[model samples]
Target: MSAFADDTAKDEWKFTLKNAYINRNFENENLKDTGSWSQAASLFYNSRMVDTPLTITDKPLKIGVDASVQYAVRLSSDKHVADTVLPFDRETQSQAPDYLKHGATLKLGYDKTLLSVGELWLDLPVTAVDASRQLLTSYWGTNLKSQLTDQLYAEIGRVEKVSPRNAEDFQKFSFTSNGKTEYSDGLNYIDLRYQVMPSLKAEYYFGNMQDLYNKHYLGLDHSFNTENFTLGSKFKYFNAKEDGNNFNIDAQNIGLLETLKVNNHTFGLGYQQIIGESAYPLPDGFLPETYFINWNATGFFKKDEKSYHFIYGYNFKDYIPGFNAAVKYVYGDSFKTADGKENNESESNIILNYAFQQPFLKGLALQYIRIDYNVEHGNDFGEDRLFVNYTKRF
Candidate 1:
């Protein structure tokens, strides 16, 4: 909550504060209440690395030093609704919810690109933060992002360490799943996007999880207007296979979504397929990362499975200019056991979001969500999430 700048410099000093409150209850009458608060400070300065005018970025010589801290607050709440929500394990609370630094980044910018070295943050679909959690995920490594042209862009990086959203300490990056697997030296990733037309674009992503797996993703998206209606369609294909000496993981995933938007109303339909002998793995832990965003409550990825969902969204912008809401219902079928038995599951989610447009609260936002899951074998549950955030640039 403080700052200082050089007397003769144009550098901008920045600070940020965020807070969120979460309450989750289960079908078994289990209730938990918690809150997370975060703060950050940084100095964006000029670097003399290149004396030439900018050719690729906003400034010819820009550098920055940024750091962030966070705290997790566990509120006193009853967890005896029915007590079946989850087994309480004192051994699991190995670390106290204390004040801790989550991010520290050294950034350099030139031309139209910027590179960051040291601890950083990622928000990709597969290796991203679990926003429902109290804190954000942080990674340690180097990243380079550049705007190559008006219609093209690229991001490349190598991250060897990670401090998950809910973890107290950093851990070596690796693929985490239902089974314990050896950690790797981290992961490598690159993403490229090209605008094929004014309203159509394509994106490709690549990731190598050390010797465990390598993943490839290709997606195409397009949106256009017809009269007062907006129509959009998105398609993505994914491939993950064993890499190096690893032979226990392999999978193929496909996703398709179509949407129609009119005024403040929007409708969407989505389909996803999972093919292969093994389930696809995303990073996980108390501080996990996952992205195969096909459903409201789960990834819906199972051996020989196909999933579908429909979504409805409304934006009060036309009515209130800063409010929006959405709901989605998802179903998964054709799950197969090793012997090929049939299993099924269903999920649904309700969400509401709003951002304040008033001058004093211009950067404030609030969101609420609920997700329900029903599976065979008499297992059914629901999760509720609430988030409040505020951000600003100075």
Candidate 2:
């Protein structure tokens, strides 16, 4: 039993449990007795498909289904898993346990056009996506995309809040009054993407974050790909205002990357800088992804921030009979109002990720994160995390 099980009144392993139910339902109905369970099984499959991505082929009408389950454990409280000081807890146990972790995405695609609805994992204006650290966060929405002409295309949609593992079995947040309290209302946004040229793409986004935050985003991405080398650059602008308050901010993020691939080995380098104005850092609960990788590193670092990261990975063409290992490192700075004083401080952190890929067993990933923080104007404490997860795809 996990330590959190003893600390909390309810079983914290709901996610794992729900995952079991979903899998068993599929096996028993679809495989055990196809004729008797046809209707029920089809409905179950359709729900899964509604939330998954559909690949576009030559056929306009296409259908497919897929799902995955992830079992994870965190050995340390270091929330942003990296190699750092250990957490203060006597037993850093699993935060979310035995949770049903699966979603199905569907596609209604035609020609160069596609429509997707159901549960989705999104990376939009970069704020919300950057801030979420969990691997699986799903949104209920529809994405309408089109390839207008040969080189131009666009995407648009609206989504609910981020739902992590065990979401189906958990009690979700709701509101009695319109935007009166936190976690009561869902977020809505519009995103646009245009490919101006073969190497460059531009994106614009606008959204209302319930009653707490309103935001705008503009970004440009350029890529250079060749036989053995790839280089990429991204520049983004984020503007946000606190709802029902006299607070607003403007921020800019510039990122550059270069990668060299040799057979099964690859090396890369990256850098990012944030500049803006705000009295204090954004709330820790919102936007955490700007700090780390794994797609869910919520946006916790505040505005007026500057950070850098380095990555190194090598793939063995034929190692361990049929497996490969990859590793990455990230380091950067965070800023916030200094200890309730009328000053601010610059914090630093280091994060790392390692994964082992085996053909039959799929892949197992381990994440270590550490934030060594301090205040230029006062006392300081930091956070550390260690996480391990297993993933299989068919």
Candidate 3:
């Protein structure tokens, strides 16, 4: 069964349980060893999309609510470790407490347009919540989206505060750059997508962080299918500038990715370059969107950096049912440090995933990931992550 209830149903609730284990071994050249291991268990409850009892202008009102709680413990003996291993309470310099997050949203539809308010999980080119960890981020905001025309869609939204993936409470939009922390009152964004043709699409996005920074994105995607294989191409560009005099930031990012798929095997090649004096900046706790092809355990967005990556993936469903594997390798160079020195970095990842197809384990899934990262002038690390998840709808 699907995780969400059928739209025809008046109301429904779903629950999920997940367990995760992560371990990292660091070989630092300048700092002490920061290796650590951690374990976490999370429970999530979500209400299916349902219409409310109220209506406006003959249109039905819709609402949704989602909540999650997580408990994590450090398995390694070290109390001081990287945030990826375990978050620490800054004030007390101790382990962080259990986490709780919840959000509710109401949507009103009119024709081809929809307006949503209250808590939201936004996924835009410029600003998006990060859900790669034990919990996902949520925002207090309002958004409006509309199908402007037959092939064009538009969206505009404003967010006031955010509850970060690792944080327990909501806070103002803030990010740290060049050893300084800058705070923003709020963030506003506009997004547009257009289907140029049957096989091509174009996108544009602009975002402004009040008194902080401004970001603009442009992208194009196209695909071609043939009898033997399918080929896809993606191009993305970003421009970042300081919004006010409070901070100084200027950067641009350009990336291109090409992919080919032949039956169960997929291959990809990508290149990304940063052109400016500063690194590409994002919200402190958020992850890079799809435009950033070189974002992995570490982002290759340093000053004047150029990166190249390759990917290969295989699906075993034809032979081994519900199994898949992938490997990615990235190398980046030509980055300048604060002291005028150049540095380089490399990252490699291997992933294995399986989902049970048997009736008794219908909703069971398992995944394992391994990452190896090395930097010419920084720390090197090897990390492993394992996840066991099960879901049921009632």
Candidate 4:
């Protein structure tokens, strides 16, 4: 008995002493446990990109898989519209083959140190804060994040590719058909975030977007809480340099909200603007993360243009167990356009959602979208989308 006890003590002592003298760097940390897994799928109907001809109706299937080690895969397939034909085709364009994306990753960490390598979807340091679309695709990149303090963190990495389908395993994938231009190697970004107060944060980022251009962003967010109402503001600025002498490309957006609990209705008003080009591009599009809500009308947010948006939501706890619904509206005009000249387009959306108390089924949502465009100003694109989604997470 004494010998067995002595042996156990010796093993514990050895382990404690070994760990005490270990000199481990962040990148050399031993691989530990594998991560979790997540899967999501959705079905939708649209009038534009998904349905090329704008004639025959089509339904698209989109599926996604994400696992530990930052591995992710996305697959998409769709039926063709029977009424529309390509330029040379006498019949409707044949259905395109399913698109696939596969990604993989590895991470090492020690104490407050961290190192990541692989393709994975990340929304830290650089991302839209309130983007909540269930079927929306995510960005992929290899980033290293270090926890500088409890309230601050920093990250830098190369975005080898930007596809929601295959996140981390893009090493052998090439965007160009000829395989000459390696798109992944051409993208890089660095960003930081710090929490000034319990409810305020400041963020900054600098990066280049392959052949498109170079850009930087700065933003500040703050929230104030009182006994009856909560007030907050999101302010941001962007500077982009086009390869050649383009118009001074600069854009900014400011959103302010005030919320009070009176009865069961919540009312909020938002305003967003585009100062430079036709619109500020992040995620390479004009969809501002600020004015993203169903029912808000967003006219083409062009240079010198300002938009006013409004939102209303209601929580019905007694009617459907647990449910909430919202609606929004937006309107805008180009600042530099003459009174008779055409400007950008306008948009509106409405959404309704319900959540269940069951364990497996968390929530379900439905959405309707409408876009009215102005072709006279070279902004002739217009379309509509009807969508419904269900999500379950474990």
TM-score of each: 0.81, 0.56, 0.89, 0.61
Q: lDDT per prediction? A: 0.67, 0.44, 0.76, 0.44
> How far in Å is the alpha carbon of 91 misplaced in model 4?
13
Give the TM-score (vs. native) of candidate 4: 0.61
Question: Over the stretch 166-243, how does candidate 2's per-residue lDDT look in tens digits?
Answer: 232212223222224344255667777777898998877876656556667777778878787666666655666665
TM-score of 3: 0.89
Number of clashing pairs per prediction, in order: 5, 44, 0, 17
lDDT of 3 by residue, 197-309 (tens): 99999999999988889999999999999999999999999999999887778999999999999999999999999998688877776645646854687878887999998
Position 9, candidate 4: lDDT: 25
lDDT score of residue 128 within candidate 2: 44
TM-score ranking from best candidate downward? 3, 1, 4, 2
Candidate 1 at residue 209, lDDT?
A: 81
Number of the predicted model whose lDDT against the real structure is largest: 3
Which sequence of candidate numbers ranks them by lDDT, best first?
Answer: 3, 1, 2, 4
* Candidate number with the higher lDDT (1 or 3): 3
Regions more than 4 Å wrong, model 4: 1-97, 124-136, 164-185, 243-263, 282-299, 335-340, 359-394
lDDT of 4 at 215: 64
Q: Please give the TM-score that candidate 1 achieves against the real structure.
A: 0.81
